[model samples]
Structure formats: structure tokens, C-alpha cells
Target chain A: MSRYHTSRSSSTTPVIILYDTPGHSPQPWAPNIWRIRFILNYKRLRYRTQWVEFQDIEATLRSIGAPPSSVRSDGRPVYTLPVIVDPTRNSSRPEIISGPSNIAEYMETFYPARPVFPEGSRAVQSLFVHYIQEVFAKPLLPIMVPLSAKGLPPRSQPPFSHSHAADALPPGPHRERAWQLVKEQFDFLSSILDKNVQDGDGVCVMGHSVSYADFALCSVLLWIENMAPHDGWARIREWNGGRWVRLREKCREYMDVY
Target chain B: MSRYHTSRSSSTTPVIILYDTPGHSPQPWAPNIWRIRFILNYKRLRYRTQWVEFQDIEATLRSIGAPPSSVRSDGRPVYTLPVIVDPTRNSSRPEIISGPSNIAEYMETFYPARPVFPEGSRAVQSLFVHYIQEVFAKPLLPIMVPLSAKGLPPRSQPPFSHSHAADALPPGPHRERAWQLVKEQFDFLSSILDKNVQDGDGVCVMGHSVSYADFALCSVLLWIENMAPHDGWARIREWNGGRWVRLREKCREYMDVY
Candidate 1:
């Protein structure tokens, strides 16, 4: 009940608890969790991250009674990270929403000003974000998991290793093949940005102003920066006329964690 | 030079020739071609369609020195339909642009008003259109080709049947499997639209108003309506809360041919 840290010296703004996955240390780098953080920062929501190790995510979510918004291919409810517990603005029960999109909709609904889904743009912006999650990020899993496992603490790395056991890559040639798949996806994304460049500033994914779509992209970029750095982000940052870097710059204001 | 039929009695307006493929009869049902037509109509440009049989597409394009905008997967130049010849607004040579996106960009550049991209929306809209073309439309190839062949004239049907010989479905079981694949894609699209509906008017693909993305979706919808209405559109039209029908209605004004 005392999850709310009401500091006597500071204003009585309710602090939202963002259940985030820890990277090498306790810092957050998980793409999905970063999506929520980006929105929180963009909307100036007061939130503190409660870091959860990879193996403890399900238990933590269960203890808090937060339900997942998605499921595994086998129909098991996927209890993943990026669950948020937000106390009502007025006096209402605290709300727990699991997925990034769900949390985003909650934010946009509750906090009407500083909107993310501007009028008429949500449909296409959602499609763009879905494509990034379902298609573009898929090919990066093989590369990302191994790199992330290396970056995470020794205690947290085992789960990633075991989880990727079946999807383990063959020694040399398979890594090349995996990177090729990532390159193909990157090339496709570049082409999409190239087309939009003629219409606007060529930096943001949505209209002239940045929206949730840009934040989604920035989350992926931040994941690569933290997990693989040179091996991953360096290889493709200059691609498609330096699109990844420009997109990162566009979302620079929201990338910070206070 | 006299391709311009300027009637002395009527208003002097140059007509653009849209080279389209003839479906079963003379109806134009190709999704890519429909994209260009949507933009032309959206811009209120005066245009006349010159229907060309599939067999004569290469020769017809070559005769007019029109270059294909895309290449086949085998690295061969792809001479596809949906080419447009727009006579200059002034005394410049007529420009022939092939491919839907190219023609759209050309229209926006020359026409310079009644915008489809809408400020800041082009990047995400372009990504949505690309996904429709590259990913969403891929699984439907087998089902669409067979049904479209049924609608084609006797002369055009043979080539389609021969080309799809390797990918031919079996009598009962394979057709069922193909429909399942189609259903899976439809389910994915429905989910995307459902998310967008929570954000805006549950109809158009982009912001509040219809844009090029909606046109892209309508193109595929029109293809299904003409090629396999009962089997294809009937099954998924009502999915995700009648999103397909609502989207179709959103772009109804652009669907008509003058």
C-alpha cells in the first residue's frame, strides 16, 4: 500500500512504478520497456523503474496481480517485462497494464495533453510500430539475445542462454546468415524513411512532429546501443543516409531517465 | 502529338493516360494499378485509362520508351503494369512513370496540392504501404492468382495457369490450407486496424482523413472484390469489427473511375 513514495520536501506527484528488465547492470535497455519510458518522459509522467531480472519477471508480475496482454505461440500467457502500475490521478484503485501498447493507450487516455497519437495519425502510426515489432525486430533476436546475454550480469545471463538454446546459432556461417537477414530488414526500413524524406524533415517516423512511432524506433536503437554497441549499431547506423542516427536525435529529448 | 483530344467547345484540359491491365474482362482490378488511380482521383486530375492485355504489356511499355520502376527477384527488370503518362502542365515533354509509389510522388510534385502524404505523415504512411506490398500481399499470391485466372478472358487465363503450375494447389486439402494462410494474414491485419480504431475513427488507415495508405488497402480490397468476392472478401470483411468495410467506405470517393 505504501508503494507511493510521498516525499515530505517535494510536491505530492504520484510516482508510477515501471517494471523494467535490467541490462548489464540495473540500467534499463530492453526495447519494450524503453517504449514505456519514452512515453513517460514525453508526457512528463513521474515514474520510477523497479528492475526485475530475466527469471523473476513472471513471479514479480504474478505477485503484483498484473495480467499479460499477449501470449506465447503455445497459447500460454506471456508474462513479460514493461508492466506498469499507475495510481489513479484522483482517489481510485491503482491500475496495472502489461504490454507497451496497453500502457501507451492508458497514458494517452488518462493524460489528455501532450498527446502521442495525434488526430488521424494513430492508425498508420500503430501499423508502423506493429511492423517494427513483428517484422523488423524479429531478425535481430538471434544477434541481440547473444549480445545481451554477454552484457547482462552473470546471474541473469543463464536464462537468456537457456531460452536461446533451441534457437542457438551454428558457429560461423549462421552468424553471417543472421546478420544478412538483419541487413535486409534494415535496408527495407531505410527505403521507407527515404520515401518520407521528400515530405518532411526526414527524421521522425510520423508527421513533422515526433510521435509514439519514433519512440518505438528509438527503443530498438537504444537496445542495440547498450547491448551490442559496435557490433550492432555501428554496422547499420550510417545506413539509408544515416537514418538511424537522425531518428535517435529526433527522440533525444525522451531518451533520458531521471 | 495530337494524342490530346482537345475539343474546341469544351474546357482545355490535358488528359493523363493510365496504362492498366484488363481483369477477367476489361475491369481493372490490379492492386498496384488501383493505387495510382486512387491518387489521380484524389488529386482530381483528369485521366483516361488505356487498357492493355497482359501479354502486350512489355511491348506496349517499350514502344512508348517507358522504363519499369522495379526489378524481378532474379535481378531482371520488371515490366509491370500501372504506368502513367502525364503530359506536362506547360510545354515540357510528357513524363511516363511506372510503379504506384513513383506515380504518386510524381503527382504530388507536379500537382502540388490536395496532398495525400499530409505533413509529417509520409514516413509512417510509406512504411504501411510497403508492408502491404512486400509482406501482406505475398501469401495471397497463390489464392489470388487462381481466382483471378478464373475471371480473366480465355486468352489471358492460359498464361496465368501455366505460370502458377509449380505453385498449383491440390483439389481439396491444399485449397483449405491456402485459405488458412489467408485467414492468418487477415487476422493480423484486423488486429492492426482494431488497435488504430481505439485511437481514431475506426475507418481510414492513417489519421482522421483518407490518405495514400487507405488507398493502398483499398487497392487490395478491390482486387479481392473483383477476383474472389465470395471466397476471399466474404470471409474476412466482417473481421476485427467490420474494419474492411469501414475502410472501403472511407475511400469510396477515390474508388470510382471517370
Candidate 2:
């Protein structure tokens, strides 16, 4: 253990297992899982990643007693794409940690080196997360169902609808609207990025050093660059090249391998 | 002053200031702001809330020397409400924490009597935050924009469509799509809640106890319920009356006021 561990509770290390989706349909989300992996990588912790076939997610969840299938009538909405198991939290049964924020925080407890959040970045990071949720993620809904269909090949997820649910999926009329909204969303993000880039700040909103906001921003941005309809994500494209490139590079380097 | 100071960094009784936009006008996002205030109240922290006029946000941003009016070509983002000033992180300059997840974490740092994350809830919280951003918040976007100028006055201040100009307000054709998409989003959230409700955890996915996820979900749920077309927020409505009400109440009492 390093000096950061000097302040930790004990000498024992934690065991973490990540159950990730195998396909490229962006089951839960690529950037979402990537960021978790990045944080794990950043911690340099030894962990394991078990890629689950989307079809088998139900069985896998049931077998581990990690949010079994019977829990939902609609088959557990976006059911646990990234589930973590740690020995530290539950010595008796090996607790299962689900969700991205949970995984990141878990890593912070046992390992705090190369911090994702600065001493005072709690709010900044949280806002970034919210921005992604509210702005970035909002417009992505229409394409999600198509993305979740495992039968579709990666990049072959779904075609863009001119209006709501033009295709025969869920009959949910949010597709055309999502497409329309994503344009506005892209503009909003570009505007925000313009502020950050002009700020003379190294990365994101907080200025100088990159915080969790930077990482979280990076995740959404990666998705935007890949998915959104903004033909010229010019401002965002440049922003990504700056701090994001370095952040993800670090996340990859720091990813803990089980 | 409070027994909650786990970090032992400051002795001057940290202060948390919230910048709020009141009365559901300028946008009916009361639940988002309420969520932050509730946490502060529950943490038992004495904090001040200043209702912000959207027009004045840019001036405040400039005064604070944060990312200023430069956000747009000339003004601020349309509605960047809820600016938190926490003195604990940096003594000279306040930690500018905004957005819900960010604010919640900020609250946790100062008032952790009952942590938002359970024993080994680190990873789960991270994932929750990610999903909220990518999934939950994304779905809510459709209903947030008003149907027309008619809905603006009651919901927001004047110059509704032109306030920031950057938003190109009314969200245009996108708003209609967004509204239609609302049902689909609900369908997804309902599924998640349906499954989790049966898990019998009585807590969020992050831990054995209710974590920030609970608070965050309630805030969004309430927001969605308010924006929803009908009184059919069945799952969330039932939840609020059942268990969420109490958990939310506890979070409000965490008063670590400065």
C-alpha cells in the first residue's frame, strides 16, 4: 500500500468485481461503464470484469441474488449493467454494489490517490453529473431502446426517426422529439464548453485543475461526440482534445484490474 | 460547533449558502432546489437561501469571479439556479458547488452523521449518479419545456424565450417531442422502481441505508410527477406516501448550520 493508505482503516485490501454488458449496443452506456473502469484504473486496484451477454443479464442477476429478475414486471429497467461486488462491505455474503457513483465512491474509501474529486470539488462534480443527466442524457432517450436490443449489431443500433416513434419499437413517440431536443442539447453543451474553454481553466467548470466534473463531463462528451446529431461539434471537439484526452488516458492507466 | 465535522479542517462553523429561484416560475423545478434545501435542513445546518432572479445570475457569477456571462456570447445559461457556497473546502474562496448530485455530496462532506452511502456503497453511488444523469434526468427533459408562451408567465419570468437566447427558448419543435417522450421515460423509471421496490432493501441500491440516491430519486420523481400530464404518478405517489416521505424527512433534519 502507498502513503494514501496510511490513513485507511486496516491493512486488508478490498475485492471488487464488475459485471459489465458484453455487446456494443451501449446496453447501459459506453461512457458510463468506461468512466467506472477509468476510476478503477486510476486507483490501480486489482479487480475483475465479467462481461455479461445482454440476454443472460437476467440469469446472472438471479444467480448472484444481486437484484434477481422477479423484482420487475418489465424485466428490471436497464437492469444492472455494471454491478460491483466487494468483500469489504459484506464479509458474510459479499455485498453487491450497483450504479456508477457507488462504484467510484467505493474506490475512494479504500484508495484515495490521484483523486477524482478535489478537496472542495464535491459541488462542482455533482453539478457536472446533474448537467449530464438533465441536459446530455435527456435527449438520448429515444435511441435507448433500440440501443438495448441485443440482436442489433453495434453501430447498427437504430435509425434516427423524423418524428416520435416512426419505427415499430415501443410506439413511444419520443424519438423525433429526442432528435429535435438533442440539437438544442448540443448547443447548450457547446455554450457551456465555450465558457470553460474561454475561462483559461485547464479542464472543466471549476478552473485550473480537473475535478470529478471533468471526468463526468468527459464521459458525456464522449457520448455526445459519438452519438449526438451536431454535425459540427466544433467547440466540443476542441474541448475534448484538451483535458478530456488526458483524463481518459489517466482513467485507462489507473483502471484496476482484477 | 456540530459533532459532524469529521475532517477537523475548520473550526469556524462552516456556512452553506443556497441560491434559489422560488415559486416554480421561470421553470417548475421546485423539487430540484427543494432537494438541496431538504438535505441542509435535515443535516441540521443553519444555512441561508437567497431566491435568485434569473436576470441577475450573470451579475452574481461575475461578482464571484466564477465562469461568468461568457457562458453565452453575451449572457448566462437560461436557468442556472442553486449556487452553493460552502466555506469548509477552501477558506479564502468558497467551494462553488452546483447541480443536485454535486450539492448532495457537498452536504455529505459537512454533515455525515448518517452517511448517504452505506458501509460499502461507494461504487453503487457512482453508478447511481451516472444512471441518473444518463437515464433518469434524460427522460425528464421532454416535459420541462412549456407548450407555448401561455405557459411561460406562470412558470417563469418575462423574456421567457429570449432570456439567454442561447437556449433558443421554447425548445422549439423539440419541446413537443420532449413532452411526448415523457411517458416513455416514466415507463422506464416505473420499471426500475417496480423492481427495486420488491427487493425489500427499503434503501437505495448503494447501501443498506438510504443514500443520496433516495433523495435524488425523490427530487426527480416529484419533479416528474408535477410535470406529468395526469395524476397518475402511481408508483412515485405511492412511494412518497409510503417510505420516501420518512427518508426524505430524515434528510431534512440534518442541520449542521454555520
Candidate 3:
């Protein structure tokens, strides 16, 4: 098989293998996937993605050595998804790059394109930080607590409705309550975006053009559109610059191989 | 006061910070304090430490239009922590550096003295990854279960026994169960460390010499000694790495200023 990377004449680009679990998941979360996809697209870099379902990451890593998972108390043993392997650096032995944040850092270090984050750009940096916190933590709502105790599927496994659970939950007291929390979160987020836009925050939060920070925030915004429409965040939904629309399109391009 | 890091520098010297809370919270679970302390000790690098106690970090950032805490479904907000602020890059506003893994990446990237983990060294990188997986995850164990329910501290406030938690966990089924679980974790850890030593993985997991990988592992090791003791981990107890010992001496040296 052809290597899943391209390069110029003098240099050989490393093969990038992304081990992902591509399901929409029970709870509808996939920030880890979009992060890698956007970075690769932003830099126009190529990589081969191998989708490893969530259950398999442990078995895959453990086939080599105990996944360092035996040390953890959790029965599931791993956290989150989208493990990446950067095979380009260190030609002798390819490095197994994992973790969502770690993979992004590796990309920034080895494959920097036009420099994504600005120097000491706290104003912009803080926004992406907030976006990460809100998006990842807010959505699952309170279903996880009740659901897990009752032996239902995890929120991340989504299609949350079971025959018994279906009647037990409504988007109102249970789901609706969670959605209300999310709606409030979106209100908080839109205010920040509005303030940044109002200030014209130099461009993309660093007083310049788009960097990784811009792409990172843009991806989170796309999630908000997909997940938090109940908040009626029409401002972000109808915003100009076509950033969100273009981002979703790019996400499709990233997903074509799947 | 002289700023520890005024701006990003072109050299490979990281701007380090020994993050702490007000009162210095005499507990082993203070992840940031131990991590940076461990890195500085392991690398034997000299830099300044900036203290932003819990209340102060909140007060300053909030006065700038940032929200102090965003509510999670748990009903309490998870506030962010100390960033390894670098002045040289990100436009001199101090890029937001959070997470132990991310901070390590920042150090290895900018201040790469003695080559942390060695570029493209798979064995070395894997060791570091293992260290992160085992040690970092260990620190999070307390937070994994409910504090009051499990007799551990709640997320929002430190345990009332913060002064004596390691020594004074009350005797009961819950406490015995927690201690038994902790002991089980230690047994597993001892087995792995024995493999490291017996397999002659040497000073580091990959071979002789403690790089950043060792630093990350050793920091957690130090945290654990403060947590509880077992007969098996005695070998690490007597470790006499002069640089590390010197760094701890320095921590002792700076005990009163804050």
C-alpha cells in the first residue's frame, strides 16, 4: 500500500496514522476528530486514518504492553478518542503520538504551516480555552450520572434511548434541562464572540489572521451550531465570512476517505 | 519585581513557573506544584517561579472580563489552572499553557536542554507516554469518585483533613476499601518499576539517563511517597540523584517567602 503522506523532492514526509472511532457516539461528541482533521487541512498535510473503535484502543495498545491502563482504576481504562500516530519524525522508529491535545502539539512542532497561534495572544487563546471547556463538558448534561447508575449506555455511546429509558427521558425535565444548561452556555459563548468581533480582535483573536487558534475556535463553533440550536444563536448561525460553512465543508473533505 | 518571563526568547530555555495555591495547600495532590518542581529537579534547570494563589488567579483574570468558572453538569464550575507562561512567543501576552502533558510539550519544544525524550526516539517517547499515562492518571484517582461518598474530598474544596489525609484517613469499610484500592495500585506500580529496573531499562525506561520522561515519572513518584508508603517502593525512596535532591533543597530554601 502507498504511504499515506506526501512530500517535496528533498524531504520525506512522515506517514500520519489516525486511530479513530468514527461513530457519532451515543451522546453526540466528536471534538477530538475535528481537531486533527482541521489541523491537517489547515496545513494541507496528508495522513492515513485508521478508525479504531473506542473499545479497541486498549486492546491495540495492550497487544504490545499493558496499555499502562492496568494502573488506572477505571473499568473502561482509557479517556476520550482520536489517537494519532506521527511516523514522519525519527525515521528509524516511528513515534506513536496519542492524546487529542498532544497530537495537535506534535503537528504544530513538526508541521508548522504559516504559524497558527500568535505570540502571547491571551485574548484569543482564552477564547479557545473557553470553547474547549464549554463544548466538551456542557453537552452530555446530567444524563450521564443517572444513566450510568441505571446500567444504561454511556452518554458518549449515544442513541441514548432504550426501550425503558426512552419513556423515562424527555427533552424536557431530563434532556430539556440539559439543553437549557447548554442554551445558557451558548448565550455566554455568543457574548464573547460578539465582544471579540466588536473589537475586531486584530483578526482571529490575535490581531492578525487565522492561526490554529482560529481553526480551533471555528471547529467549536461548528459544534455549537450542530448541538446547541435550541439557544437560537442565529448570530453565529448567520454570521458572515462563511467561516463555519467552509469549516463543515472542510470537515467533509477530511471524512471522504471514511 | 522582576518578571520570571518577560517575553518569549529564541533560545531553548523555558520560562518555568512553580504554580501554587494560597497557603500552599500542604497536600500531595497539588499537581502543578509537584510537576514543575519535578521537572526543574530532573533537568537541573534554573528559572523563576511565579505564584498566583487560587484567589488571586481568579481575581485577576476575572477583572479582565473572563468568567471565573463555567458551570459543569456537576453544578460546580471547573476552573482552569496555572499556565507555564512564556513571553517569547504568542505576541508577548503569555500564551495560555495548561495541562501537565501540554506544559511538558512546551518545555521540550522551547527549552530543549539535554534533549527531552530525544527527537524521534520511539522507545524514549513511549516511556514518557507511559509515565504520563500511569503517574498523571494516578493523581486524578481521588477525583474519580465522590469525595464525601467515598470519604475522599469534594472537587470544590480540599478535604478537611488536607493537613493529614495521607496519615489520618479514618478506619472503616470505605477507608479500608480506598486504602486497599490504593495498595492494589501500588502493587501494580511496583511490579512495573521492578520490570524497569530488572529489564535494565536503566535510569530511564528506555535506557540510562533520566530525560523528561523520567522527570514526569519521578514527579508522580514523589507525590506518591507523600501519599502512602509500602515496603516495595523503598528503592526509589533512597534515590540520590544530586540534581533532584538539589532542587528539593531549593524548594526547602524558598519555603517562607510567599
Candidate 4:
């Protein structure tokens, strides 16, 4: 199968285009998109953001002839957000990589100087990212998605309802139950962060310098701050003995688009 | 409350006593205990092992006045295995550290030269261990426990059944269902390990040397290898391009008890 790449430009150094979800306002709420953005900024790679509306993700991906990074349990292709078109690296044609981990791997291979995996720590760091994406993010989904739905543009609301209606947290008391779950997950995370204070400089998630693992975590935190500040990040920023706050501060510079 | 330390002698450098669960044969199958054993050997710390049967766990712990590492969701204390009594490190009164993470922290604080939370990677390393213990190990419980029960001593079998009867994987098709869950978890792990080969030496889980993260993973691998070699470990040892076998070889030195 041919790989998908964006249309080329005049410059020798091809600019990479990042596709992100556009929320109620201008910023992106999805953690997966923020993950790629964090890596791009961290590696000092030049990139531009293309704000795709929620309802248009599948269509936009298919129109570009980009392959989905993964498939559903039943083997159906899952065309998700956070696909990137890195034109200069890999091939003469701009290379489009789908999914957060896939894009991170591509960036790491092409930009080895600005290392995210870090020496021999790749295996564990990958595991850390996997946990953040799969296990750590599970509880926050219920709380974050519904609150995020409130900020969605009217055009995007229908698809959000259609896709996530059953999975989204219900209003009223169930919200409290979901919050309880969120707290439980944070409590576990807090205990883990406490180890940093005891062992290291207590700043970044991995080593003194930032890595992909930190980006993976900070993305989740950013999602909370962006999508549901009152419902989630507000409480988390203060909890865990301000570990969350310090973590964001450590990675705060990378949040900026280059 | 006062901490419980194992009865000790007058040596200048005090020895630590590790509590582990003994299987039917002369081997340890519990991942949590294997975790501490790995740390003790990695640090080259002088320690002795005390094998406790499953039936005797509560009574033995209570007799020693050892505090349970954690409580259940309902708030009752959980008298689990893998507690360590470390002497001559922190206080004149030896410290009794319970649980894998707790003991690992004690070792790191005392033995900084042979580091587990390498450089400034404590937070990420801690999260990695947490995920292994909490998330990655969840699906294996059902598959491991019932199979492991067959290997437990005759005296230890009843209480193993009593305490874990409801949760143990049932006979026949339920066992198949458990194996299915186990395979799914391994598939996720194999993807993570594939990154190591792509990025680093593809042996250790974390940085160059075998750190605590490797121990955490190896502990699970060892549990499978010892508990149900044919049923569980055989399938995984070859999967993910032999990531598990290479991981075990990387940490093989630590598997030997002092």
C-alpha cells in the first residue's frame, strides 16, 4: 500500500502539518492530538495545526487516503484524530503517520538528537505511555467527555451524541460517582509522583529532561485543563501535593506551537 | 504504632528478611514477592527469605504484629505477602516495609549507588511499576490463581480457596475466557516491547542496567513461568518476538536468592 503524504511546497525543508480536534473555542481538547503537538514542540520541529471539527475526523482522514493506525476489536479500521503529515522526514513525499504512538515513533527515529525514549529507557517509557493512554485515561473519559461535549460547536454535537452517548457520564449523582473514580485514579498517580520528591529533582515525570512519557502524561493533564477545568483539572492541579502543577510547569514551554 | 522487624543478631550491617509465598514445589509463583526478591538481589543487599504458605498469611502477619500494606475497597486491612523487614538502614529499630513499591523505595533511599529510579526517572518509573501491579497484572489474576492453586501445598489449598473462591477463574470455559483476557493483555505488552527493539538494546525494560521497572515486569514473567509454564508463560515467552525471555535473561542474576 502507498503511504499518504500531504501536497508539497516550494521550500527544501517541508513543513509538517498536525491535524487536531477543535473544541468549543479555538484550542484542542483531545489528549491524543496534544500528545503529537507536545512532541513536535519538544523536538523543535516546525509544524502547523489544522483544526478539524469533531464530525469531520473520519472524512478528513479518508479524503487524504491516510491509513488508520489501528483497528477496532472487530478488525474495523478506527479512523481517529491526531494524524500528522511529516513531509521532509522519511520520504520525498510528505509521510502521514496516524495515532499518537506511531507519530511519536516516527519522530523519534527521524529526530534522534532530541530523544524522547531516552537511551535504554524506550521499553519502559513506551509502557508508561501505553498505561497513560489505556489505563490512566479510562476514569477521566467519563468526566472529561461530557464536560467537553458542552463546549463542542453545534455542528459537531450530533456526532458526539451519536458516538459517545452511552459511554459519556450521566448528569447528576452519577457525575459524582465518576468524579470519585477520577479521584481514585489520581490518588494512585499521586503516590507514584511522591516517589519523585523522594528520589529525584521532583520536576519532570522521567529524567530531569523531558521525554515522551512526560508528554503523554501532560497531554492528559492539558486535556483536563482545556476541556473541563472546573470539573477536573482544577482539583487535580492542587492535589497530589502540587505534583500535577509542577509537571505542567515543566512541560509548559512545549505547549506553545512552533 | 511501632514498626515490626524480624528478630535479628548483633552484626554491624543488619540483614533484611523477605516474606514470600511458597508454591507446591520449591519455587515462588507470586509476582509481588518476586518483585522484592529482585530488588534485594539487584542492590546486592544481604537478606534472608521466609516462605509463608497461603493459609498462614493472616495468622503469621498478625502474630508478628506487622501492619498490612494497604486496605481493601471496604477499608479492611489486606494481609498480603511480600512484606520485608529491613534492619540497620534508617533507624536503630529496624523498619518493616510492606508491599513492593514501599520496599523498593526503602532500598532506593538506603542504596542510592545501585539506583532503581535512575537519574530523575522516579516518577515515570513509579508509574510504570504502578501500571504493572494494578493494570497489567489485573487480567492475569484469574488465569494465574486457579492454575497456581494446583501447585499450592495441601495444607494451603483450603484457605486459598476460601479467600479467593469467588474471584478465582472457574473450571472449563471460564478458564478459556481468562486465557483470552491474558492474551489481550500480552498483545498490548508485546506492542510496547516492540518499541524497545526499535529504540534500544531490546533486553532490559528501562535504562542500560536492570532497574526496578525491569524487576516489576520480570516479576510478572517469573510468576507465569513458575505457576503455569505450559498454560500461560509458554504462550507469552515466544510472543512479542521473545521480549519476555530476553527480559528475564537481563534480570536473571537478580532471580537468585542470597
Residue pairs whose backbone atoms clash in candidate 1: A120-B207, A120-B208, A121-B207, A207-B120, A208-B120, B24-B151, B24-B152
Q: For candidate 2, lDDT tens digit of each residue in B1-258? A: 112333322436665677765443333345557567557655556566665555566577557654321256566453365667776567687877656656776567567765664432333344455566566577454344332222333545465665432242254666556544655654444444433342224334322344555666666655554444243244444532355444434444442322
Please provide, for model 3 over A1-258, each residue's C-alpha lDDT reduced to its tens digit, 9 standing for 90 to 100: 012233322335556666655444222224556666666756666565665554465677655332241235555565444566555667566666656555666676677564443432222232344344545345643533333323322443343343343332444566666756655554544443332332233234333245555556555554444444444234445544443454344344433221
* Candidate scoring better on DockQ of 1 and 3: 1
lDDT of 2 by residue, A1-258 (tens): 011122122336665667876444333235566567667655655556676765566678767867531245656544555677777556678877666766666676557787776543333244456567666767565554343343334443343233344343342455455555765665555444433332224334444554555566565545444443253233445443454455444333333333
lDDT of 4 at A175: 84
Candidate 1 residue-wise lDDT, B1-258, digit = tens? 002322312335667889987777445788899898889878888888888877788989989989977888988787887899877465268888888888888898788689988777767777888888888888888888777767766666667666653354655988888878877877887677766665567776754778888899888988988887887788768766787888887787776564
- What candidate 2 gets wrong by more than 4 Å, as runs, is A1-14, A25-29, A68-78, A88-92, A143-183, A193-200, A223-258, B1-258
Global lDDT of each model?
Answer: 0.78, 0.51, 0.45, 0.76
- Candidate 1 per-residue lDDT over residues A1-258, each given as its tens digit: 012233312345667888987667445788988898889878987777787877788988999899976888989887987899887464367888998988888898888689988776766777888899989999998888777777766777666666653254554888778878998988888777766666667777764777898889888988988877777788878777788888887787776664
The CA lDDT at A30 in model 2 is: 54
Off by over 4 Å in 3: A1-14, A24-29, A64-80, A122-131, A134-136, A142-169, A198-208, A218-258, B1-258
**Cand. 3 TM to true fold:** 0.39
Which runs of model 1 end up more than 4 angstroms from their true locations? A1-13, A73-75, A90-92, A163-177, B1-13, B73-75, B90-92, B165-173
Better of 1 and 2 by lDDT: 1
Worst 10 residues of 3 chain A by lDDT: A1-10
lDDT tens string, model 4, B75-130? 99988888888765655687777777777887888777688767767777777777
Please list all clashing residue pairs in model 4, or write none if there are none. Answer: A87-A94
lDDT of 2: 0.51
Q: How accurate is candidate 3 locally (lDDT)?
A: 0.45
